[model samples]
Target: MSLPKELEVLQNFFVKQPNPLLGVETIQVLLFREILDFTVLRTEDTRELNTVITPLSTENDENVQRVAFLGSKQKAVESRQMERLLRTAANEADYPIEECYLKDYLCLECPRCALYGGTNASASKTTNANIKHRVAYSTAFSLAAFEQIQQTTTFNGISDLTVQTGQTLNERISVKPATIFPSIVTLHSVTWKELILMMKIILSSHKYGAESRIGGDVRNTVVGITGGWEEFITPLEFTMELNSEKEKSLSAENVTKILNKYKLLLANQKKSVILSPEQVDDMLKFISGFEIDKKFLTKAYEDVRAYRDVQENSKAKKK
Candidate 1:
């Protein structure tokens, strides 16, 4: 009912390395009802729930029907006493044992939709949604009893704890990294562009490494759509163009084409400024063009633009 005095208790609670598996948490519950009462305790076991729960086709059924219990794993760490108590509870509650698990935390099959009856859109992928929802729901319940303190605590509340659609849990959860002492932090809004851009940067940074990129395909697709200009060009090619001494000798048609390409891919509200073909080209050229400081120029362009805008705003205010 109350939060543990020690935060270590909370961490240890989740990092449950018991006899069988690693990273498991156990919860014991004593349920009380009108006439019949029972108790049950279930431990979080690291049995992988990787089953894909999708709609099943029933004969001429317009309502999307699902196989309620397909590929369900019975690999829970339940004590004999806990099992007995749960059995008693199921009988008294007049619900099937399966149903109880489905409703409770034991249901790893599907995600707990907090906004099921409210506003959140229907989850696109059941497995992915379940994983996210499970983490969020468990986290919410785990921190439920923590009294909300001001700036120092609580992430300001539940809303602050949320990862926007494209944002990551690790990034959103802590206002700042726990290691960072005393800094202002903003909870970032999740955007598809942010996710795509982050993925591209990551992949580009480490594609040479042995570690497989998780979201490379999505990132590529996004680049193709957003950076319509330089999709076919490799980073190497882009570098060449950026550093080419022949740009001055090139025809006006070619110059116009290059500039137009950049304009097309620049950041817009419809989408985040992804690595457009033009920027990719620009970056490549920057890398290749030893004549000019490509990185410096790009960064300087951004800095100058921001400074000029700020100055303009100041002047306008004065006026």
Candidate 2:
């Protein structure tokens, strides 16, 4: 997924890679999600529950265990999950990747390595180097409070988003269907390709939270995107800004309106540019039509092989 030369102006939004990430340049994005079905988003069992206490209103005083989508949950969706999907797609297209998909293997050369930071999966600090994750995600909070918007049930018989009562004995807690979670994702020093791909991943991905293999169904929307030297806002702050409203849904218009307030800070107008609804839609249309072809996959594999060779050669020298 690449942009045209005319769109090179958008490159101003991303920091030039191959350089240190000073955090000054960033692309702040707002991602809104709706719970389509049963989704498990919990840390640990709290009396067989997975929730945390947090403010739930514009007042910012109330706190409760509304279904919270942790940052780690979506990070995995974008990193490990997206990487696995890419590999599968490549192999299906007959452009098989030599790099293993095992998480522990940490080929260290895949597209996500530098984009999603990780510990030296080799578990050897001296031999392997860690990559910095350029993208950052924030935990999303449900608009509806826990008591009103969550359901718990015990059942069996499930395959690909269906629940059967007699299949087996399983019990879990999930938020009510159609619940909304307003989120913010920040990208630091990402290239044009990385930024667009992130949008595709966010808007296209269907599953979220724990136990996603069976029953974590979600739909995500890219509300708005801002490019600037500073991160515009957080999920919590975005929530607060819209808390006064009765409806908690995402639309390109509302998103632009809220973010437009922060377009200029103090007397500086160059700090950021909040994309208009039309611009956002244009980008969305482009991504929907964009296809990752054999050429892209071939170059991706070549880069992976080259990076792995370099890392191996470096390790050998250190030995």
Candidate 3:
């Protein structure tokens, strides 16, 4: 029914209903995800998401492609992350869960559709045509350069039945353990329950990038939440700012300080309220225990029906 006192400052950002336009409030979440095992993040061409760039510091003598995480990869994983919980919520609310995909058939009538967005081009139907993504994601690069973070290993495919190695060993290039990715995700026009759902996903998601089922164990650590009309701190900025500190010796406390650098600014106007890591931890714990109630899912489903009805009426009038 309400947010905890620690997260109360973000109450104003939560909208009573979802609106593509005129939803000015934004909640930017800061994260420092560390790779526990390894991940294979690639570019559109399927090659490793690494490109050569000038040396970030004196560590590198020449320019070389640095492996970086891409925004699309993050969005895909996050979008997929909501599937199970969304279906459960729909079942609890007594609504049919219409399956949706990344770029395939979009039902355009689910909470997942509302948050991640989708497009329906069913030539005959035009109701609720397009849904804009409420959650925004940006790419984050490893704090360590690609060379320093990458590891190559060969593994033989052994047959379970025969217990024999395959004809050839396969090579895998992945981000090594302890590699950190500083990322920020922005949520727009979301309700309190939606916000809680998002936080839960962030806390629970442990894998990212390719071969997620097998490897790619990245641990997500949300340092804080900044609420306002606009209070976004980019991953590039985080990487840059943290790079200097990293040159010496970077610690969790240093990262937290970097996250709060912009908080003190524009305080008079209430543009944003940045949470400290301690405060963030407290809020995370509070939301972890909360569940997505049936009432919230019901309202979301009702909105979908209302939108479809309105669109149908408009199309009828035109015809």
Q: Give the number of the best model, judged by lDDT.
A: 3
lDDT scores in order: 0.23, 0.68, 0.72
- Which segments of model 2 are wrong by more than 4 Å? 1-9, 16-23, 47-49, 56-65, 92-98, 123-128, 156-170, 246-249, 264-269, 298-319
- 58-128, model 3: which lDDT tens digit per residue? 34344445567887788787777777777766778676666665565667776677788777663323346
lDDT for position 297 in model 1: 27
Q: Per-residue alpha-carbon lDDT of model 2 for 1-319, expressed as tens digits?
A: 4455534546777643323234566787787788888788877755243556766655556665666778888887767665775787787788755464436656555666656655665633234566666788888777667787777787766666654445657777777778888898888867665665677778778887666787778888787888787777778767766664553445678778777766644244576678887777787787677666777666555544454566567768888
Candidate 1 structure quality by residue, lDDT tens digits, 144-250:
01122101211222345563354233211111111100000010221121122222222232111011132101111111212211122222222223224454222
Tell me which of candidates 1 and 2 scores higher on TM-score: 2
Give the TM-score of each candidate: 0.16, 0.80, 0.82
Candidate ranking under lDDT, highest first, comes to: 3, 2, 1
Candidate 1, which segments miss by more than 4 Å at Cα? 1-204, 207-319
**With candidate 1 superimposed using the best TM-score fit, by how many Å does residue 151's alpha carbon deviate from the native?**
39
Cα displacement (angstroms), candidate 3, residue 8, comes to 1.3
